[model samples]
Target: MAPLEPTQPDCVWRNVAGAGKAECKIWQFPTRVSRCTDATNVTGFTWALTQTWQPPEGQVYKLNFDAAIFANLLASVVGVIIRNDRGQVMAALSLKGGVVQDSDEAEVVACWKALEFAIDAGFSDLIVEGDNATVMKSIASGQTDLSRLGNIYDDIHCLARGLRYMEFNSICRSANGVAHSLARYAKHLDEDIVWLEDSPPPALEALLAVSRLRLNEELEFTEL
Candidate 1:
């Protein structure tokens, strides 16, 4: 947690594909950004593998995050997206989770943040959604039955048995507003995390940080 004064990225991005071999590095914090939140909340993982053509049985995991990010004070950013089967967007996650305990660890931290975006977009067939319906019925009732969030729902069903064709559903928070606006723009970053192979980057339009809540509607991070 000492070096990160230039362009940051030294802390995440670990995509490992097996058998046929495929690897991406940057596992330690060094590429950039890491002022250290004083060290504590740590759990970063990314996965994805392929021998040829995997991820296809209904694949679609997109759990949205954003408890309104302080509603007026700003902070809760927890976005997760995984779209497979050629529809593209195989993986995306923007974390900032902070609105105090995040509604009981916000679906066990958005189901281990969609299993670190399905272990880095190995995507073999998954269908997950959120806007929090009890963390999509606690990952479609596979029985993470609480007992202290059963290891984040058993590490999201063991990452859906290392993917090939996974399925978990419960989408409706208005079909998850673009991963809840990138988890309220990842609460203005403290460790700078971004993984865009496609869109939403222009500092997200000066961090719009949405909202409308009378009951539900959130987005945060304001400084611009």
Candidate 2:
């Protein structure tokens, strides 16, 4: 079969309540895979939603962060999880904060908080991943941001200087489910929560789900 194409344009404009028009991009990925056998065997295919969390490089730690906006409550929640190269959880945090203007602000705040959490935990070399493309791009740009959230970006850049090594990565939401789940789980919390060498109950299921999907993908690739 031929490869799939995007159903929408690369960029679209949408009107926001107080922000006027905003530019956004939609990303699409294949949800199925097909494997064809040789003439001696019957052809078959299988379909499943696959997502995986990549491990960090040698001696480096991976930090995944996400934010959940609670518009009704006029607040936002941030979740951060750190893991070593062996995929062992080193630390995790779920924090609740004041209202954010939009998802973009909330995402930036989450990234800032995640960096702070990692620094406080004595992690010097790190790979930070988040599902917000815009926020990630801004952080990775290594240039001054003149936008409203420039201060936060400045703080993040300042924080990065203290680290021996740091990288910013943007991943799809499916791959960031653990942090997403933890952020959502913070809806019932009144203060910041932190766990060392462990994860909260809400994130355990998501962590396991991601592990299974990754294993299945590896097995399929090996078979192919």
Candidate 3:
């Protein structure tokens, strides 16, 4: 048999024509070095970590809320869930919010609706929670909101004043999971829905584990 010849520029086929004529060449690859900045540059900056939902102390009730916007549907949806110090659902709302400009607007609408829901439920001592940090910060700081969302902000502020004790806070998305799910579910609804002392089955299932843990904590406290 004949020795093989090189087929492609980078590859070689040996023993094609004859043993002595066989051409076998080794290929060398260049070493590649990537220079990265000092580890301190990346590790130096730190951000405050977010926390999950916790039942409010005393007789306060927490309203965890979120919104979802569907551009194709030209609509927005809001979810508001009120839970007591025991972390059990007291009331929940799913509203088919009208058309909104953007996510900020959607969240603002959700915030307003949350206050409305709380007030309608006769909840005076309440903590309003959402995942939009900017909106929450604006409300918490009592900054003079001037954006389009300012209208909703004003409504929420006025309504909040009616409560004896109220606070606006932002939680991480992990803590707002149930509200997120409910808002996403509302995207399919054409009309608003409200449940008193009840929540959507799906959201209830999602909150079950958390509620159980809270219940265990309460039992421990009782024993103490």
Candidate 4:
């Protein structure tokens, strides 16, 4: 009998004076639907804590390398920890390599620097480790690099060839905590620094932590 008032913002009222009533119609808008897929779901894969820093065998040395990039400053730095089979920190290096285009390039630089360090130190048998699996795999394949990091990769390959034996392996970032921390520390440095038979105080805790791990491991074996 009476015209109904529009109760919603999107509804409009139509005059129906002849019928003695007003009609209100509301338009329905389409709602956006979002589909989110978990990375594990899409690839049918999951990550596990399977990696840890392990000392090399016998006289061989293990070098864990990592790189940190500062997008704001357009610079990158690399950190390397050289440890003997006993897990003793023989030497450490942190280098500020000016600038790099991406994290991949930064990692390449780190690997290259590690190789150079090994060469200078007269290390013949060494194992190079990094958190970047792709870079490690590429280097291990010994393939040509026609990409942006070709020069860096070529240098790495050249240095590696001088070694009696050099093995490149990738580990999870969690396993490379010491090198990762050192890389971050290098971000504020003006130049590269190298320590022999010692590590900077900032990395002392991590070194000690690894030493403790080694001790525990030795004790376990002795008990066995």
Best by lDDT: 2
Q: Write candidate 2's Cα lDDT for 103-213 as tens digits.
A: 999999999999999999998888788877677767765568999999999898788767776666666577798899889988889888999997578799988887788
Task: For residues 1-224, write the lDDT of model 4, one tens digit per residue.
Answer: 33332211121111111111112212222112112222234211112233357777878888899998887677888888899987778888887886777888889988988888877877777778777756765675566879888888878867766666566654557668889878888888888888888766668877777777767878999999
Q: Model 1, poorest ten-residue lDDT window?
A: 13-22
Q: Model 2 segments beyond 4 Å from truth?
A: 1-51
List the candidate numbers ranked by TM-score, top first.
2, 4, 3, 1
Ranking of all candidate structures by their lDDT, best first: 2, 4, 3, 1
Tell me which residue pairs clash in candidate 3: 2-16, 2-17, 3-15, 3-16, 3-17, 3-18, 4-15, 4-16
TM per candidate: 0.29, 0.78, 0.71, 0.73
**Candidate 1's residue-wise lDDT over 153-178, tens digit each?**
77766666566544443333544566
| Highest-scoring model, TM-score | 2
The TM-score obtained by model 4 is: 0.73
Clashing pairs in 4: none
Model 4, residue 14: distance off in Å is: 82
- Alpha-carbon deviation at 209 in model 3, angstroms: 4.0
Model 1 spans > 4 angstroms off: 1-80, 83-100, 112-150, 153-155, 165-224
Which candidate, 1 or 3, has the higher TM-score? Answer: 3
Q: Rate the local accuracy (lDDT) of all candidates.
A: 0.46, 0.73, 0.67, 0.67
